[model samples]
Target: MTTTGTSSSDTTATGAARPGGPGQLAGRTVSRVGFGAMQLERLRGDRRGALALLRRAVELGVDHVDTAHFYGNSFVNGLLREALRPEDGVLVVSKVGADPDPGGRIPLRPAQRPEELRASVEDNLKSLGVDQVPVVNLRRLDSGPGLRAEGDQAVDIDDQLAAMTAMRDEGMIGAIGLSSVTAEGLRRAIPAGIVCVQNAYSLVARDDETMVEMCAAEGIAWVPYFPLGGAFPGIPKVTEEPAVLAAAQSLGSTPSQVGLAWLLQHSPNTLLIPGTADPGHLEANIAVGAITLDEATVASLDAVPSRSADVRIG
Candidate 1:
């Protein structure tokens, strides 16, 4: 937390050399299709296996990774530390607003207070073994498909931003990002120089369509979590859609790949951080950039019904 931000004049990275095509995140060029380390918690007991998967991602030209200190109680962060080399220019993005609750069935509890957010940043630095986090997302608990802040946890956005600004100015962090935020929240946070937004969006889940476009217009990255959707209640799975399945068959790709490709083509600023513990799935997720959907297929997928989801990426 003592390191200064990698202050720079280059507003974006020329990421043609990276995977999933290049896009900006935290003011750096990173592959639009990055890796999400949350799923590595399932490999907590298999350190060797986890390390191998992460290494394989780097080999595929992945240059962006999204993680959180509360993920497996910092278990995933530790794996990133061992598997990723800072010299490789991998931009690690971490989110705060929740802490691991090992004793709870859900294993996560909101820690949204301003002071707690600051502490979470330091915890992430220590766990990930980084001098300065390239990007630290302030995951607002104002609304959620997950735990909501209550009582003292319900702090003002200004107060939270104040803490984050102090850290950025002092060089503890490189830039700021937001997650699980609404249109109004993103507007209020604009002056802070937000570099990205992580929301629950996918081909089947288009509730944040406007927000995604806003980010694009503002030169902010739109990092969608649960890009392929999941089994959670209300969060529809993208692979099950009839149009997606048909496109996969015609293009000789998986339904999952079709869903991911659509998101990339949906918005130029959109970044995908699909997580998987399987090596094969990791390769497929990164290879999504090569899958192209013609206008006709894209239109059909876009025509598919959009539904509201109770759960977004936490």
Candidate 2:
């Protein structure tokens, strides 16, 4: 298994400042810096290692985890079911709108239709052995880092929400969130009580700056996906930035830590789900919530400017 930089003792020594800190999310308090389970895809062959990695993250005081039924075609969810315990109190968040493209060239195929999304939720519930999901992010595939909706996959936001609302009413899901959606779509979903929004966002990818602000204004958790960009178009590598590297050197921390710290400091409502199977990296990512950047350093990093690119859905 693995973790970020700070050890459990190191985090405890500065618990107030570290412990990956907690923030409000859908009426529940969860770590501001949580874990994303995508990286576990490769660890499937090593079940023990995968379980330990997930357990290690929880031990580091991570109380939030972003996952999806489509990830590894639900293989990751099986790991979560085995690794996480009820007393852990981890707010396991899942997303719908794509099904695993099993035996296909692509990793995922669009499942944007309302019924498909409902089926994905059912898959999550069964795979995780949970009766009701805490929060389910409806992934609108009008845009992509992965799959995009075309043909029959092009479904309206209102219709997708209708299905989600029905499930929520039946106690099938605790809360609802949006993923890969637009400002206009978010605005329309206000009455639906969206608890969060997930999009490809980071220090360099500021195209969603306005939307982040919008979420903040409305008290919605802006749970950005690729906070430390990974081969996404127009999103630069945070580790490669001179300012980030210099800051990391000065702070005596890794560039990845600084990059993640910037995200925590970027907005009050922001929550992180940077994922990794490597223990050191996991601990480093969680430790980011504790690393505070000085105003000068933050300004320098900010000056790097947002390389806005089109990743939109209306």
Candidate 3:
């Protein structure tokens, strides 16, 4: 995979764009390198910085931008809308479900009543400042164990599909996606022609390996939300891995870049949405697209020891 684009103003802040991989979403060609908008809130009080990164993303040729109403109280979507022109050929993918309460807590369980799903879609459209979002993922609860525990019945896949189909028919969303889904869950949802699947996958995380392969075989885009791992404290950073460090040193690239390149090479259908608040880091993230790993290097990096499976996301 190779990306083609000149460095933007934020290039120095991070790095340059690498070659990009190929993927099609709703019949539109998209670069596998996507901007994750979770960092927009870090610049909330400093809107200028957030806007700059958003604009820089477009200028850098990032066609896909991921956000969610549940992120930063829906401020991230608004910032995205404010930063880019309406017809700039950017694909905005937002997730619904897990509406946080006033206390800023996402329920351990999901509540996707038909009416609730409808309202969530409407709110997402309004918050995103677009009549139709390129993709809307129905986020499932991060529960453990049994299928019933994951809120499978809370929002039936058929019901969700019906809602998404209605939105697509109404031109409110171009495609539908699913996040945090299990193999069984995805099997149930597959009939909907899910365009994408966002799950926690990285060099250290392979919980979604089967699902990722399934998406690849089906020509559906597989989006790894935490391609570099979660932002929370105590989580292992991809940059800290010995393999990533060595690769970065050999290529004169950053660890983040190496981590992302590893993911791009992991699967043709894989798309990464690594998020960063600093313009420099964002540019560096995009530049990872340029780094290529030789077969030996790819094997060595793939052999790096990962943390225990106990750390896996539910």
Choose the strongest candidate by TM-score. Answer: 1
Error of 2 at 113 (Å): 0.7
Over 1-314, each residue of candidate 3 has an lDDT whose tens digit, in order, gives 11122222322112333236445665556777878988777787999888888888777768778888767777887897788774456678888765645453332234466566678788888888777777889776542221132444466667777887788788877788988777787888888778898877778767677888899888889898767764454556787888889988998898888989999888988887878898888778878777789998899888976652223222
Residue pairs clashing in model 1 are none
lDDT of each: 0.84, 0.82, 0.72
lDDT of 1: 0.84
- lDDT accuracy of residue 76 in candidate 1: 92
Candidate 3 residue-wise lDDT at 174: 76
For all candidates, the clash counts are: 0, 10, 11
Instruction: Tell me how many residue pairs clash in candidate 1.
Output: 0
Residue-level lDDT of model 1, residues 1-314, one tens digit each, is 12222323222132224555667776666677888999999997889999999888877777788899999898999998888865556788899999998998689988988889889999998999987888899999754467777789888888999999999998888889999888899999999999999987888778888898899999999998878876587677999999999999999999999999999999999988989999999998888988888999999999988877556334
Per TM-score, what order, best first? 1, 2, 3
Which scores higher on TM-score, 1 or 2?
1
Candidate 2, after superposition: displacement of residue 225 in Å?
0.8
Residue 145, model 2: Cα distance from true site in angstroms: 2.5
What is the per-residue lDDT of model 2 for residues 173-275, given as tens digits with 9 covering 90 to 100? Answer: 8899999887888889989999999988888777788888999999999998888775555557888999999999999999988888999898999999988
